[model samples]
Structures are given as structure tokens and as C-alpha cells.
Target: MSEAAVDISTSSANEIAPGIPDPYSLPLDKIDVSQGELFRQDAHWKYFERLRKEDPVHFCAESENGPYWSVTKYRDIMHVDTHHQIFSSEGSITIRDQLEDFVLPMFIAMDPPKHDEQRKVVSPIVAPDNLAKMEGLIRERAGKILDGLPHNEEFNWVDRVSIELTTQMLATLFDFPFEDRRKLTRWSDVATADLNSGLVESEEARQAELLECAEYFIGLWNERVNSEPGSDLISMLAHGESTRNMDKMEYLGNLILLIVGGNDTTRNSISGGVLALNQNPGEYKKLLENPELIPNMVSEIIRWQTPLAHMRRTALEDTELGGKQIKKGDKVIMWYVSGNRDGEVIDRPDEFIIDRPRARQHMSFGYGIHRCVGNRLAEMQLRIIWEEILKRFKKVEVVGEPRRILSSFVKGYETLPVKVHPL
Candidate 1:
């Protein structure tokens, strides 16, 4: 018998129709931040601020996704994130529960032993030593990308610079055919995109794109399986004892994980950094004056952007957290975006501080074992890009409001129009 498919009938309220409830009119406890519209319009900050102040571990009884406990405060989010044993990452890591028919078992959504083993297979690709070797190449590519940009004219920075640089890096990581690298970006987008987000016309189209992704990777796997192990992610999985036996579905799952893991976090930050610096002229001036601060500023940009808004974990057992009782199998969302901005934990969390003393102390890369493996690599790319930007351009001026991605999962810009004025 063929495997079951995703239930097209099941959907978030936002996907079902085309409206978000007025979060403002709802009672303080009634407001749900899971709605994609909140992030799309960039109206989530105030809601998170209210939750942090009044109800740190706020529960929304109903949402477009489902009932979920939103952990907004920094300390509380840390408690849940650190104690992964109690808050299991199994099944899914997004607010939306995985469909029974369509399950993708990536390590990030797996519990220990399995998660550790699979993650270890790919860890070396982004290990400190590997990152050190990559810096020169990253800087070279960044310089080329910056030089290639149109001068003194408006262009979508998201497409021209952000996506191009990161996609190039991703292609390199997978040892993918350089000519077809944009397919990697398309698959990454489709993997994170929602049906109502205009990325795909319907659920059917999204599944078709992902299936195509799976099919494409299967051919790569076949080629690698018979060859000597190389440095790319596919070879790592092909040779690693823990991952060598991954089924087509499992291989596809890990493929999506690496693609999005490699793509979105860095790509979004590339665009977010320019937008942040442009918004805060003083910070931009500080960066221009002292290029030495670019490394620290990279961390601040990651923290400030919080590329991924939240990561969900299901409760393994009944537990008390931040004065709220979480039942077994309950959906708990740790809002990294909110925690990064919690003033109690981060001084002036709302402000973009380029030279923040504890700049690296943020939950954007997450906490504990699941902390982003490519963090150093992401920082290196940002630092190199900014260094290249400073060398060639006086300013990457943001000329209009960024068109934010319609996603609470991937907090990012779809387009950021900017004009580069050369030094």
C-alpha cells in the first residue's frame, strides 16, 4: 500500500480564509502571536512586549495553528530550552503540528541519541577549523557580490545580495552543481513557506515542489553512495554510520533541514543587518568609523533579527514553568524573537547596539545541544559581508519599508529596496 498523504482539508484559519483577528481587541491573555499576518506586517513586537510584562508564559487557548503555550520571557524560554528532556522536540518544532501522513524526521526535531548522532555527522562541515578555512572564500565571494551590485540605483537587496551570497555558499556546502544553485533557494523557500503566503498557490503546489526536491536529492544520493566520501553534506550523510541507512523520506527530511538551516538563517541576516544599520544611523556611523566592531556587530545583528521567530517543543510530561502548568503532550513555543528582546535579560533589548558588551548572549541561535551548528559560519559571513560593504560602499541605504516574509516560522524580508552609495 502507498503511504498516506497530507490532509489538504487541514489548515490554519489564516490559510482557510484571508483574515487575522484583531489582536488588539482581544483580552491580554487571548492574543495569539502564531498568526503569520502579525509577522508579515511586523506588528508582533507590541504583542510580545505585553506578554513579557503581564504574562510571561502566556497560553492562547485557540489559534490558527492550535492551542499553544507561548514562552515570551528570556529566563522562562531558557528554562524550557535547556531542559530538553522534559520539553521534547519530537514530531515537530513549529507551532503547527506535523500531519500524520506527512512526517519529515530531521535531527532538530528528534530527541537525543538519534539527534546527536545525525547532527554529529554534519557538524564537521561547520566546525571551527572548517569555518577558519572558509573565511577567505566567504570574503572573496562577498567582495565579488558587493562589487557586482548596481551603484546609485534602487534594487531588491533580498534577491541581489542576500539570497545570492547565501545560496552560493549553500551550493558550495552541498557540492551542488553551481549552475542550478537557485533551485536550492527555491526548495528552501518552499520548505518554510505557508500555503496562504503567495509562495505557492495551494498546499498541492507546495507538496509538488517539495517532492521535486526529494526526487532531485535522491539522484545525488545515488551518485555519492558508490563513491569515496567527500566534504559535502550529502557525502557526510552517505558515509556516516548513523545516517548511511536513511530512507528516501528520512534523506529528504535531513536535506530540507540542511537547506533551510544553511539558507534562511544567514540569508535573512544579510538583509536584516543592512536594514538595521540603515534604521539606526548612529550604529551605522559607529560601524563606518571602526570596522573592528564588525565581529561583535554580527552577533548583535543575529540577536536583533532573530531570523527564526520561535521553535516549538511538545511536553513529555506534566510540568510547571513560569507559574503555568503544562500538561503532557502540550505544544510549547519558545519565542526566541521575544527572548532576544527581553530587556531583563538583554540590556536595551529593543535598541540595536552595535558594540553590545554581551553581544553573543542571545537565544537567536537557540540554547543547549540544538544551538545552531553553523553559528560561527553565519557570523563569519556577516562579518565578511559588512567588512566588504565598508570597503566599497559608504552606505547601503534602505529606501523603503522592507516587505517582510509572511511567516512566524521564518522571520525575514521578502524584499528590501536599497541603493548603494560608494565610498
Candidate 2:
């Protein structure tokens, strides 16, 4: 793997309107990073800028399972995200799915009225006021998780801190049986990781695990559907109206989606924030000096880490972009990791400054109606977690190399070994 070289896709060079010149032409699979490696680094920014300027809308024909277009420019993604009718999210959101009727969740897989309908049930539940109520619980959990970290010992922050805290908090919110919280996080990771990738296969073990999650949730949803409305998301989901009520099957599917969406992504953010801070000690010091900056620093971490790097969006109609022509049914990969560091939008795009002028404008949470439903909760978690970290620890240092996942879709650390000391 060449540190200076970034993988660039060529489909855009042929079909895209002339915008930027392609510097490196490599197969999409060639550009992927392993779990512990620092990927999509400064070099990635150069490739993205070249694409944005020359072929802002290019295609990567050799994604592991299939070919897809890479959309790197900021405005192009925004345009596609806004025009949901033209650039649809429902048909082919993931590149490796081979199912017939297997859309994962109601809202994440829908457009407009239906998307709005499904999102309405829980959007209010995660709103600022509702999220504010969760801060105390989140802080308590974050403290317990961090405090329990072994003193004078190195540990993988991903499993010990990131996954544990995020999943436990998610269980708290979902009213899930806390004993099964780890099961929820594991299933969510497997289900969302590229199916073609080896992590999740058609093996009986995988199938049984998935069925276990479904059966557990099916029972929970069945009870809630008949019971009265409560404050938790499950109660609202059970009681919410639609053209038809979401049956136990749909509720289970949506539960898997929520658990995955809310779990791994934010867990990655929490872990990634620690990594970014350790990498840039100055930034870490800034947060420690003025803990108030924790809120603003959350955006910087999202941009720097870009946990769920890019989501696949299929085009509903033939479209022309950056001089390139895209056909109907074409799959476009929105590289939010690239777009967040777009040279046109961000200054010193490669540098990790904790307080960039327009840091909030980054596409880490994504754009349009599909913007992360747990975004507020994610920010709340980060702010409170780090605020508590600052109170407890004076210094944090990465003790060893991080292990990154083999799959390309969910970009995050598999193992982040680090050591921390109390102030």
C-alpha cells in the first residue's frame, strides 16, 4: 500500500463532464484500507479534489461485489441528496446486497412522504428536548465505562470504551434487555458490514444469530404493539400510524436498522474522537483547557473520522453531471469522507483543526432527509463523554497501531489500543 497514492475510480473520467483530471486510476477495491490502518488520509483529499474539479461525479466500476459511481464534490452530493426523486436511496443503498425484497428499514430505505411518515415517529423522540433528558444517563454511562478502564494498562478502546458505552446507552434508550446489549451491537455490525465481505456469510451461525435478534425483538414489539404508549422509542414505534401498522416483522427490521444506525456509527465516532485527539495533542489540549469547546469539537471529529465513509445512492433517472452522463439504475457512492474535506468548501482541507470556521457544514452526518436520525444524540454523547474524560484524565495516548475493518462501507477502527492517565 502506497502512503502517497490514493485509489481513484475511472468510470467518472469516461462519462463525467470534464471537471478534474484523474491522477490515479485504480480499481475501487484497490483503494480500500485494513481495519487498523489510517485510511482516507490527506492523500485521499487530493484524489477527491481532482475528481471534484475534473470529474466531480465519477464512477468506480470495481466495488468488491459490483461497480458504482463515486460522487466526491460537495455540491454534487448536496444536489443529489436534495433531489431525492432523481437520486434515489431506496433501490440500491448497499453495493453487495443480493436480495429480492430486502430493504433494511422503513425510513433509511424510503423517499419523501413515506420516509417522512416513518421518520416522524422517532424524530421527535430524539429531538433536542428529548436528547437533553438523555444527557444525564449518557454521562453516567460514559463515566462508568471510562472509570472502569484498567489503570496503567493498554486496552482496545473500540471494544472496551466505544462499543460498550454506545451499545449500552442504545439499549437504555430502546428499553432493550441490557444483558442482550452486546448481542445487539454484534448483530448490527455484521448485518451492516458488506455482505459479500467475509464478516457475514450465509453460514448457519450467522443466520442463527440474525434470527435470534429478530425473534427477541419480535416478542418485544408484539408486547409493545398491544400495550399503551410509553416514553421510549419502542412504544412510539408500536403505537405510530402508517398506511398500515408496521407488523412485528417490519418493527423488527426497523429495530435492527435503528440499533445498527445508532450503535456502530456513534461508537465509531466516540472511538475516532479519541484517536483524532491523540493524533493532534494540541487539539486535545484545547478541549481539555476549555471543556466548553467539546460541543463544537464533535463536528471536527465527525469530519476527521467519517465513520460510515460513504453510502450508495442509486440514480432514478439518467442524469448529466460534471460533463459526465449517468444512466438510469446507475449506483452512485456518495463519498462523504471525501466531500467533508473538499478543498472548495474547507480551508487547509487536510489539516485537523478542532474549530474550523464552517466545521458544521461537513457531510459526516450526511445530508437531505436521510441525515442521521441519531445525530443530536450522537453529539450529546460526544460532548458529555469527552467532558467527563477531561474531568477524569489529563492525558490520552495511542499505545499501539489501530486495527481497521476489512470492509469498506463502515470505515472505523476494529481495535484501538490506547493508554490514559488520570489528571
Candidate 3:
């Protein structure tokens, strides 16, 4: 749990490249990036940079989660992401494989026909037509949130705006009670948080909270089961032919996946946007002047922040990748955060440019069959928020350093102190 020392205030990439005299003197295999502290301290960038340059498919013989292969290069990660037949997502999608009896059977952790069938059930929720319908609602909420921010006073943007806005959307999607919307936020945190990260004290505590989430959702599921098919997520799952008879544990798993997936990416991106803008004032000026660039800017923000750092896949068979031999059942982690910053695939990868060409050519939404289903919905929310932000506020001043979350899986802010300036 030792945090790696790193200074992220400047825009410079780490200077430790291939064939250079090693300052740290640690061997390639000795460097492990899976420690949650690396991310909590914003220190993962240097290690990943070194890996992308020196050992794109580096292996760590030992870690908290045991041995795993690190895939840091862009094209190599894309190859693994697209070729699900070779690198499977069946057992788990985290560096730490799921516990024996606690395996969550979500589609992101599945392969093949079952994955396609299960994912199809909720696909229509974020389809183009549905997005069109959700736009006005999102705009109204964003406007209200922006209007409510305390002017010339520091506040936690992550809690007051990021979490609040996303939780409201999650409530609407689940058709859950509006009064209990914060419960959705709590459950989302519990679902993704590591035990020592302080969200929950132990695995028992985490599962207890999740089961409570399941119990609450079960009540909603019961109500929706007998009702006519509708657009809400619960109703869709209850009515979809393939999902109607989901086993209790499987149902719980899928619910958690949707809750966390729908909540994390967009919320973190919102907070990250504010932080990035304050850090790079010139880009903020460009955004303020040409609001139309917000769409492209949204993609860039997602890429730069890289909400989820990596997604793990188990090797289905022994295969050669990036000139490294991988054995069957080996854990292969695709570092999306690293790939997004890969200089080979992206121009000016380290700098945050709002108007970069091919802004969407990044790994934030992932690739292949397990690509985020709600990606468009997430982008729409960001675009709407920024549009509303431009119409009202001139700036969101980041008054202090952001407090980051402690898990490597969710790369995000826990608090970003800021004050809003009106236009």
C-alpha cells in the first residue's frame, strides 16, 4: 500500500526511456503498477510510460493479486481487446480475479453467445432514439446543478455536481425513488471500492451492502416483472427474453455492473474536465470561445482522464503478444490509460489539447464486443453539461489539488475544491 512518489503538476512526461541509465534501478519485472496506491497518488503515469517504452508486454511474477502480464502499448492492447477468442474476459475483468463463491456473472466478465444475448437486453436503453429522448432531461438537470453551485466559494465539485448529476440519471434509468437517489451513489462506490480503501471495512461489509442493494432492486424488479415492458432498465431486464429468469446471484452481479458502469465513467469525466480546464487555462479559453468544440473536447477529456485505468482478460490459450509468451489462464491487463497516452497512436499524447484531430481515436470506451454500451449516453451527458456550463459560468477555479480515489481500477477524483465565476 506504499504510494509511489510522483509529481503530476507539470505537463512533462517521465524521462526514463529505453536504453537510458536507470535512475530507479528497478528491473522491468520488479515494477508493479497494480498497487492501488500508485493510482491514489497519481504516480502511475511514469511507471506506465517506462513500460510502454521498454516492456510493453512486461510480466510481474508476484503481486497482491499474484502474477499477471501488463500490456501497455496501444496496438497490442487493441489486438487483445478485439480478439476475445484468445484473451478472454470470462473469469474476471479486474487484475484481482473474482473470489471463488463471490464471482459476479456480469456480461463484461463473460464471453461469446451468452455475453451477446445478455448485453442485448439493455442495449436499447442507450440507443440513439433513447438518447434523443433523454437530452432535454439531462439539460434541465445540468442547468439546475450549475445554478446551484456556490459562487466565489470553494466546494467539492465531485460530490455536489459530479456524483449528484450522475446519481440523478441513474435513478431515472432504474426508475428508483427520487428521494433515495443517494443510495445509488453509495452502492456504486461499495461495488467498486477495495476493502482497505475505506469505503468499507471488509469483504463481508461490502457484500452486505451489495446484498442490500440487491434486496432493494429486487423490490423494483418484482414491481417491474408484472408490468408491461418499458424503457427503464429494470423493466427491460425483467421483460427481456434472455434476462427474465436470471438467477439471484447473477441478477445481483448484473445490477452491480450496470450501477457502477453507468455511474463511474461519466461522473469522473465531469470532475476531470474541471481539473483539466483549470490546469490548462489556454484550452479552457479555446473552449469558452468556441463552444461547438465541446463535442470533440468531451472525447478528449475522456481520453485524457481515462476513468477506468485498465481491464483484465485471462489468456484463453498460450499466445505470443508483443514478443512475449503468455500461458493459458494467465491474467493479461490492458492499461488503457497508458494506451491513450501512447505517442505512436496519439499526437501530443501528454498535452491536453481540446481541438486535437482524431479525438475519438482513444481506448476510453474500450474495443470489441465488451465495449461500453452506454458510451454515447455518457458523452451526451458531458456535452450537455459543458454547454450548460458555458451558457452560465465563465470559469470553475480549481483552488487546490484534487483528492484522488484509492483504487487502481477507478482512476478518479474523490474531491475537487472549486469556486464558480459567473459570465
Candidate 4:
């Protein structure tokens, strides 16, 4: 951690001030749902509930990331997500504008022709054929991980299980050096860590770590660029016509995008599913009675967890959304976290029902063009892990409260203490 970084576990910029009123009690204009502390404390639900009901397309005139519009309803968020012409993804996808001097131009942050071409370059990796090929390996690795856990002894499941499995999968995707696989996890954290989150001390430190990530990947790029075209991600980028000519920053940007995409969603969901099942004991009982529900439960887990809370877009033109006028260039945030729990679309929105009908209809994987490229892979990983867990464990008990990551952008866990009881 950087010396300049504050330990957000103890103090955070977004912490509700002493004596501040509850989410509904506060003035509508005073509600800023972008606060990291609200998510960290797991106290953000009621805030979004208020916004979804009273002001679905509310604007906060002031926030740490500056003024922005919050689109909380499922339909409105789907509108912003699908209509790329109106809500552009060109600038930054998070509320915080990318630092002018340190901008990294990955495909997710690019528009049209360029974005389409670059996305096509790597999309093949997650295609149906490739996912089928990877399934056996994923299941084999997942079983080995579960077999290694100490029975009836408390341990941080996020570190021991979640991080380990995802890091291994990331290494295989990139064909990276297996011994240094954890570096991918580190870079993912540095790329999205809030300055006050204590993950990195300052903006300078964050950039420094990301640059080091760039240097390491650059070495791999050099190795793969000259070789015959290969199936690994590094080789795909090195040889793809659309991406072959990318400059250093653009390369780094795409690398960070893939790393975070591959790691965060599955890793966090693996941890989140356990915590969710433990909290909703009846759901766990249902799953134990019938393991066939794992696939549907995987989708429900992603919806309930909403690993990535919100994705920000820049309004490209003046538009009317939920009766609010959004001006050109204004930052618009689609709160997927809130939209996933929208009552208008999802029945019993707050409950975690593993066998819920149309479980796949949630917005955890954003809609339209920028939807998660690795959506299938994320689901497969979660399903495989849970299936293996059921085969070996009677239950995986959450013994302590989870410590959540202090960033609204990456809704995830830092640690979750648990104990496994063998079947």
C-alpha cells in the first residue's frame, strides 16, 4: 500500500457523516449513491431502493466523482446500456474520469468501428467451442482446490478458494507463467482500487503498479508476436490485425481490461455465493436437496451479488430518460446493482431464490454492445465450483462477516472467513 493511502477500513471519504439521516430521511438531492463506504458497509440497498422508487433517474449535484445522473430502474438502465448512440462509452466507464495524463484506451472504453474490430479480435476465446474445451479443465482444477481445503477449520475463503481458482484460470487464458499467476490478481486490484481504499496509497502509486504490469505483459507480447498464431490471449492480441498496431498505452489498457474482466466477476461470485447461501439457509437447504439447480443458482448468485455495481457512460446527445433531461457530455451511471433488484421486472426482487424462473434475465452482465465478453466463462466457473463443493462438503459455513472491497465500481470481497464440513 502507498504511504499516501488512508486505511479506508477505519475511515473513508464516503462514510456517512455522524448524525446524518438515513437514506430515505435525507433530502433527495443529498443522496449520492456513488459512495464506496455504503457498499463496503453493505448499507447501499435502501439508498438504491429510495432512488428507484422516488427518483429513478436522479441527479446528484455534488459527489466525490462530480455531478452525475443515476439510472436505477431495470428498464431505464437497459435503455442506457443498449442505446450506444445516445449513451457513449468513449471516455470513461466509471464515475471518476480517467486521469488525463494516464489514460489507457481499452476496447470497452472505445466506440464503434474501432471497438467492434478490437472486440472481434478476442471474442473467439470465449466462443462456445472454446468454453466446452475449457470445462473439463475448470472442473478438474475446482475439485483439486476443494479437496485441499482444511475441514472444519476457519480460513479466508476469498483468498484460499476464490482468488486461487480465478488466478489459475487467468494464467491458463493468457498462457502466462504459472508461478507468477498471482500478479494478474494484484494488477486487477491496483487497476480499480480507490485512492482511499488502502489498496494503493496514491494515484502515482497506482499508475506505477499498472506500468509494471504493462512491462511484464510487454515481454510476453514480444515472445508471442513472433511465434506462429496461438490460441492464448497474448498471442491473439499479438497477431490480430485489428489489435496488432496498438501503441503501448492501448496495449496496456486492453490487458488491464481482460485481466479485470477474467478475474473479478468469477472470483467475487465464488465468494459471494457461499456468503449468500449461508445467509439464506433455506436456499442452501434447497440446493443440498437437489444439486441440479446449480446452473440456475449461478445466474441468481451473479444477480444477487452484482459483482460490478455500476458502469458509467457519457451522454452523446441530449435525451429524455425517466422524465429527466440528460445533457450531452454529462456522466450517466447505470446502477446494475440496483437494476438487478428491480421489483418491476424481477418477482420478489430482494430474495435469493436459486430456482427462480427466468433467472438469466438479470442485468449483472450489462445489456447490448458492452455486455461482458466473458459472461459464459464466468457462469461456467461458478457452476463448476459449486458442483464440486456439493460433492465433497455437507456445507461450507461462513463463520465471520465478509470484508468487502472499498470501491463502488468493483463490488467484491477482500476476505470471507469460512469452515467446510465434509460429507
Winner by lDDT: 4
- Models, CA RMSD each: 7.2, 5.6, 3.9, 4.5
Poorest 10 consecutive residues of model 1 by lDDT? 1-10
- Per TM-score, what order, best first? 4, 3, 1, 2
- Give RMSD (Å) of candidate 3 vs. truth: 3.9
Q: What is the lDDT of residue 376 in candidate 2?
A: 82
Candidate 3, 1-423: lDDT as tens digits = 112334434423442322222324677778888988777767677788889889999999999989999999999999999999999989789897778967778888999898999999999999999999999999999999999988999899999999999999999999999999999989989988977888999888988898898899999999999988889999999998989999877898899888889899999999999988887888999998899899999999999999999999999899999889999999999999999999998998988899999999989999999999999999999999999989988898999878899888999989999999998
Mind sharing the TM-score for model 4? 0.96
Over 4 Å off in model 1, which ranges?
1-25
Determine the backbone clash count of candidate 4: 2
Evaluated against the true structure, the overall lDDT of model 2 is 0.72
As a whole number from 0 to 100, the lDDT of residue 266 in candidate 3 is: 94
- lDDT (10s digit) by residue, model 2, range 1-423: 222333345336422212322345644334332211223222344456566666677766554456677878778778777778888878445555535544445567778888889888878778888888888888888899989988767988899988988888888877888997898888887666544446777645565676778788777777877887777778778778861377544665677768877887888888888878777787877777788777788888888878777777777899887677889988777878778778787887767788777778888887888899888888888888888888888876788766666555677777888888888
Q: Each candidate: what lDDT?
A: 0.88, 0.72, 0.89, 0.92
How many clashing residue pairs appear in each of the predictions shown?
A: 0, 19, 0, 2
TM-score of 3: 0.95
lDDT of 4 by residue, 152-210 (tens): 99999999999999999999999999999999999999999988998899999999999
On TM-score, the stronger of 1 and 4 is 4
Error of 2 at 3 (Å): 9.9
